[model samples]
Structure formats: structure tokens, C-alpha cells
Target: MEHRELGNSGVEVSEIGFGAWVVGTDWWGDRSDEQAVGMVEEALDAGVTYVDTGDVYGHGDSEEIIGKAIDGRRDEVTLSTKIGYDFYDNPQAGHGELPKELNREYLTEAFEASLDRLDTDYVDVLQLHNANVDEVTPEVRDLLREWKESGRVRALGWALGPSIGWLAEGDAAVEYEEFDAVQTVFNLFEQEPGRHFVETIRDSGPDTSVIARVPHSSGLLNEQVTPDTVLEDGDHRSHRPKEWYETGWEKVDAIRFLEDPDHADGTRTMAQAAIRWLLAHDEVASVTPTFRDGDDIAEWSAAADVPPISEAEYDRLEGLYARNFDIDRDDGMDVLRTSVDGEDIEAAGLDKRAASY
Candidate 1:
């Protein structure tokens, strides 16, 4: 896998990284602890050097599994984990969001606990998990810098969301230029804030790298949830409206040209193509697709080696996106949670209704 540095932090990450959320929680599906470790091992064997996990994931279960999976090969990967959510004192009610504490005292405690779970002295990247714009105070900034200076954290970042639509928070992070990376839900289908952030970096000059998560647009771009496929109860994707998948499948069919072998770069699986599309943006440093199993890792880990999306294909995609993939129907994502009364979303030119979280 190709490695790219996160901004100028000197922390390199694989082009295709493993998002350990799948294993940490049954949000995707249930997998035994052994199976989770095996999947991580599989990803490492396939040359994936970036593994991202959050302390809130199964209340640190994901990090522990990742630590076990990477035992004795710690130097071989660029490890990143997020904090901010205080799941310790709060009970997780299904997929309900938890209270976040970004104060220096709480964050310090959380970071130390995370290290204990991962069995590591330090992490390459430490991010604020789903931090609201106001939560990124000067005190938090000082704490992040302190960690970096203390050699406990190599880089600092802000991971956006419990879901998509944190445009204002992402923009503020880029403008602050304090973070090495900003992780978000960005893909061909849902390109609002990600596109906005990339342009913000280009037009201005933060140099903060973008980490594209949920690159498959919740399994649509990867064809994992086909039109006829039924999502079981408690599955995270089941929360999305049925119309979302219907519209997504239609859009996926329209982009099949990306899989044609006649392209100069050669053919690509829909999954790889989805990742490649994100990499086409210069600001994107990594794409962390949720790997469900060993086969999922094998196919996506090689995305860096596939023929890249050519300029023409990219333009075609932009055109399709401009026209809403030629389908005149709502994708059920028009309204998104916003912290600043939708002012930020409006400023970003995203035509979605802003709902208070």
C-alpha cells in the first residue's frame, strides 16, 4: 500500500487504512474477538499500514483488539485513535450519542486510559472524537500540543461525527491550522463538507490532510448493500431511509464506467474505485474503509495499486454529482445536524436543512 504523510506532521498513513469500528461494535455485525484480530492481521498482511479506532468503540474493545492484532509489529503501522466521548460514566443506549467532555482534565484521563487499553505508550495520531466547534478551546489546543511535545502523540486531528454533516466543525479545524488531519464521512454520493474542506485548504493554506471515512457511502458505492439486499435489525445502515439505498444504487449503476478495463488506468472494483475517487483530491491523505472480513481487506487494501481515476473519469463523476446522478428524487439526506443553526452549512453552500443535534 502507498503511504502518505498526514499534512506535514511527518506521520505517514497508508492510502487505504483499516477502520476498526466494525470490530469494536456490532453496529456493522457481530464478530468474535478472535475474528476481529484475524481481520486486523489480514489487513496488515495485505500491506495496510493505517488502522483507525475510537475509544468509544465498544468502550475500548476495538483498541484492545487492534493492539493485540498488531502485537510485535507496532512499528509496521501508523496507529490512530480518538477520544472526547465520555462513555465511561454514561451507559450506551443502542446507537444513541454519548456526552462529550473536551476539558483538559477529562481528555488527559481519557488518553491515558486509551493507551492502557491499546497497550501502547504512545499513538501516532490522537483525535478529538466528534468535537463540536465550541469544544475545541484553547485549553484543548494546548493539551494536544503538549502531547505532541511530550512525545506521547505524534500528530493531532479532529474526527468528525457520529454520522455525516459537521461542515462548520471541519472548516473551523482547517482554518485553525492546528490539526494534522480531519476525518469525515466523504464519498462520491455525499460530498458536501469534504469537498468544502478540500477547497478551503486549497484556496487558503492550512495543509491539514483529509481522512475520508465511510468511503463507500454506507455500502452503496461498494455494492455491499444491493437493491434487493435486506439489512437486518440493529444494523447501523438500517437507520437510513429505504429511499437512500434506492437512490444510491441508481447512482452506483451510473458510475459503472469506472470499472471498464478500457480506461488507461485499467478496471477497478466499485470499492476500489470509490476509494480512488477520494484520493483524486490532493488534500486527501487516507481512505479508511470499514473492512468486514479478510476478503474485504484483501480487495480494498490493494486499492492503492489499482489504476487511478483518470481526469476524464473524475470530471464525469463531478458532472454526474452536479446533476444528482440524473435521478430527480430525494436521497433522504437533505437535512443534517448542525451546531450553528445551519449557518455554517449554509455558508458552505450545502443545500441541506440544518437540524440541531
Candidate 2:
């Protein structure tokens, strides 16, 4: 694995970070604690130095498993986790909605819990998981300041959101705390928070970095997901529009070199090419996700160097954008619509800007 500077914090981590999302094993499926830990060990052995986990993932089981995996090699890697995206059951009813979990008390409690679960006292990066477009509040602003001041966290960032996490308006990030880093979705098929976001993070200098997650777009960009494939109900890919998720593969099935405007060049596996495109940006700190085994890990990690993509490749991707007007091309990021849309765009469009470039 290669190394990159994570914003201005001066923390250098492997270009490919280990995502603990799969280890969460909540809605997807179950993985034994031993199996999850083994995967973490595999990633670590593969030179993955940055590990990202969340407190709410699998009710913190991910953190606990990771904690056990890196019990002794704490100093060999940089650990990143988030506050927010709480998954507590509602007392009055059966439902859940995105909530602000970065308030001082909530963040503190979350951080402490994450630390305890990870069996670590401090974290390399403490991000507010899935934060939104609200103006900076004293609670979050002060809590982040405190995290740095207290040395419990070395850097700060926003996990963006399910709506903003993978796509967002960096405008909200500006004038905030310099937001040492930002994480979002930037796969080949999903490139709203495109190169511009990466450039902005780079332009921010060493003070800011970008982390790209879901580089595979929850498996749509992968090889196995064909137009005829049907995702089971509990699968994350199942959440996507049934027609598109199952049949959209046709849109990307084009000649490899032809650079079909409707597809991002179907030659190479979109899974690898998609992530490769995101990593091409000099500003992106890293691109990472969970791999089922060592082969996929090796393949996905090196996705950083998937033979140079063509400008035509990007244009093809943009053309794919045309088909999905549901996507909004914002400053430089992409996001899911949280509220109603304007009269013109009609339905909600994604906010794909990560930060201003």
C-alpha cells in the first residue's frame, strides 16, 4: 500500500483505508467476530494503515471487532471513527430519522464509547458522521475544538451524510474549522462530488483531505451486478430503485474503448475503474472499502493505479449523469435530497459537491 498525507494533521496513512462498514454486519449479514477481526488483520497486513469505523455500525460491533484485531499494533495505524448516525430504537414508535449526533455531550459520549470499543484511548481522526447543511452550531463547533484541545482527536472532519456523506455542499464546511478532511462517495458511476471537490481539498492545502467511500457504489459498479441481477431485500443494493438497480447495468455495458456516453467505458471492471477515477485526483486523501478477501483487497487497493483513464472515460460518465436527472451537480459534491426540490428540477436531486475547489 502507498501513503498519503491526511490534510494538515500530518498523519500519513495507506492510500487505501479499511472500511469497517461491512464489519458492522447489521442489515447486510452476519460475520463472526473472529472473521471480521481476521479481515481487519488481512487489511493491516496488506498495509492498510487507516481504519474507519462508526459507533452506530452494527451497534458498535464493528469497533469492538476492530479493537480486538489491532490490540497491539495501535501505533502502526491511524484510526478514524465518527459521531452521529445514532441507531437507537424509538420508544413511542418504530422508525428512525437522521439526527444531529455531534452535540458536545453526544459527541463526547460517542467518542468515549468508540474508544472503549476500539480499546484505544485516542483517535487519529474524529469525524461527525453524516452531518448536514445546518449552520455551524456552538455545540458541534465547540466539541470539535475540544476534541483537538484535549488530544482525544488529532484531526476533525464530517462524514458528510447518507444524503451528504457521499455528496455535499462544502459551502457548509467553509468558514467552519477548516474541516481537516471530508468523506464522500466518488465512484466512476457516481462522480458528482467530482475532481473539483478533490481539487478544493488540495487547494485547501495540507489542512484538508478527502476520503472516498463506496467506491463500488454499493456493488452496482462491480462485475457481478448484471442488468438481470436482482438484489435481495436486505441487501444495500436492494434499496436502490428496483428497475435501475437490477437493469441499470445495461447503461454501463458498452465497448471498452468506445467511451459510450451512456457508460463509463465498459472495458475494465467498473468496480476498479470507478475507484481508480476518484483516486486520480491529487487532492483525494484516500479511497477505500471492505473487500471480501485478500484478492479483492489487493485489487481494490491498487485501484489507485488502474491504467490511466481517458478524458473520454469521464465524458462517458457525465453522459451517464444525463440519464439520472435525480442527481444534482452541486458546487463539487453529490448528495441525496433531504428536503423538497425546486419547481424546476421537480424531484429531489443529489448534492454531489464535497468541497469548493
Candidate 3:
């Protein structure tokens, strides 16, 4: 595995990190704590030094499991966790929305809880989950400054829509203050990020990179994304059944149909092809592709090491997209917040900021 700096935080992590979401709790039925911990240890062995988790993941179970795995090997990895609103912060999308504001009250409470659960005094990067940068008040900024100054957190960020990445354009709160890192879901299926998150790093100016999660779209990019595939009942994906089976496969179906072979263009398996599609984008710093154990690690890592497929393959994918593929049509970033937004780019003066990236 390769390593890169996570924004300007001065922390270098494995290019491919492991997300602690699956290991922490029973988001899907039941999971073995020992098995989850074993996976964490395996991730470290695979050179996956970065781990992303949140207090709400499995209700702190994920963070706790990661804490145990990184207990003594603290120096070997970079740990990231989120506080504030839960996954279902949106009232409609309401899974874990806390009925609170992000004032000093929530920030402090969130941080302490996250740290305690992770079994660490300080975190490499601490973020607010599903936050709206435009709405981030002055008080929240002050607390972010305090946390950094106090050395309790090396950096501050948000894990939401790609649109929130556009928030950096506005002279508002943490976004302009130079957040440490932001985690967003960007894969071959959904590829429009404000790219500044990693391009800034490539340019070597205040250098901010990304910790991309769901590089596979909740397993849609995986081999089993066919309509017949069944997801575990408790999976976070259980809520988005339409996205899982019926609606999310324009790109995947297009590419697979055109390519024909499972690992086409000499050695591009569907999963590898999907992973490579993201890696090929210059803006992506690294990704946190998920796995269950050591054998899973071997497969993804192998995918990363494979040589790039031929131009004929690229043309095939391009032709397929032109003929059958379509861009993401879900325009509900407010409901499903992203770290960046395209329309807001001009609104927030991010068009000029966009140029810098």
C-alpha cells in the first residue's frame, strides 16, 4: 500500500484505509467483536494505516473496536472519527439525527465521547458528521480553533456531501479555516467531487487530501451488485434498497456489458476496474475500501497493483457510458449532504477557489 498526506494535517496514511463501520456494531444483524478486531489488525498488516469511524457508527462500537486494535500501535496509523449529527440527521433521512446544535455544548460532548470510545486522549483528525458548512456558526469555529490549539485534535473537518467541499469557497467557518481532511463517497458510480480536497495536495499549497469512503458504492461496485443479490438486513444499505439493486447500476451495468469478460483488458476484474476508475482520477488521494478479513485485503491490494488496462478498454468504457451510462440524477445534496457541490461553486465564490485546485 502507498501513503499520502491527509490534507495539511501533517499525518501520512495508507492510500487505502479501512473503514471501522462494519466492525464496530451490528449495523447488519450481529457481528463478532473479535472478528472485527481481527480485521482491524489485518488492515494494519496490509499497510492500511488510516481508519475512519464515527461515534454514531454502531453507537460507538466501531470506534471502540478500532481503539483496541490501535491501542499499542498508535504510532503506526492515523485515526479519524466524527462527532455531531448522526447518519440520519435529516428529519426525512432521520436515522441518527441528534436534536441539538453544533455550539460548544455539542462539540465538546462529541469530542470527549469519541475520544473515550476510541480509547485515545487525542485524535489525528476529528470531524463533524453530516454538517452544513454554510450553517456552521461562529461559536463552532471558535471551538474548532480551541481544539486544534489545545492539541486535542490535529485537524477539523466534516463528512458529508461533496457539495460541502464547496463550502471552502465561502468565508464562513471550518471550511475556510483549512480543515484537516474530509471523507466523502466517490466511486466510479458517483464521480463529481469538488476535487480541491486532493488537488490542493497535488499543488502543494496548504495541501488538503481526502479519505474517500464507499469507493465501492455500498457494494454496488462489487461483483454481487446484481438485482438478485441480497444485502444483510441490518446493513446501512437496507434503507436504500432502490439504490442497492435497481437504480444504482447504470455505470456498472454499462461498463460490464461492454467489457464482457469478468476481468477484461488482460486483468481488470469488475471490482478492480471500479477501483482503478477512481484511482485514475488525479484528485483522489486514497480510498477506504472495505473488507472482512486478510483474504479480502489480498484481493483489493492486488487490484491496486495491477497494471492499467489498455486504451481499447478505456474506449470501451467510454463508448459504453456514451451509449448507456448516465450521471447521478439524485439532486438531493441537502438531504444527503456532500463535502462539495457544483452549483454552489459560483454562489460561494468557489469558482475562483475551484481554479486554485
- Which prediction has the highest TM-score against the true structure? 1
Clashing pairs in 1: none
Relative to the true structure, how large is the alpha-carbon lDDT of every model?
0.89, 0.65, 0.63
Candidate 3, 151-258: lDDT as tens digits: 888876667642324334321222355575667666654443434344544555444555567777666777645677676654666656364355566556666742
Clashes of each: 0, 19, 20
lDDT string for model 2 (206-235, tens) is 467778888766666666566656667666
Residue 74 in candidate 2 has what lDDT?
A: 96
Per-residue lDDT of model 1, residues 161-232, tens digit only: 878888888887787756999999899998978898899888876469999999998889888999778888
Worst 10 residues of 2 by lDDT: 339-348
Give candidates' CA RMSD values in order: 1.1, 5.9, 5.8
Assess candidate 2 and give its TM-score to the true structure. Answer: 0.80
Comparison by lDDT, 1 against 3, better one: 1
Residue 205, candidate 2: alpha-carbon lDDT: 54
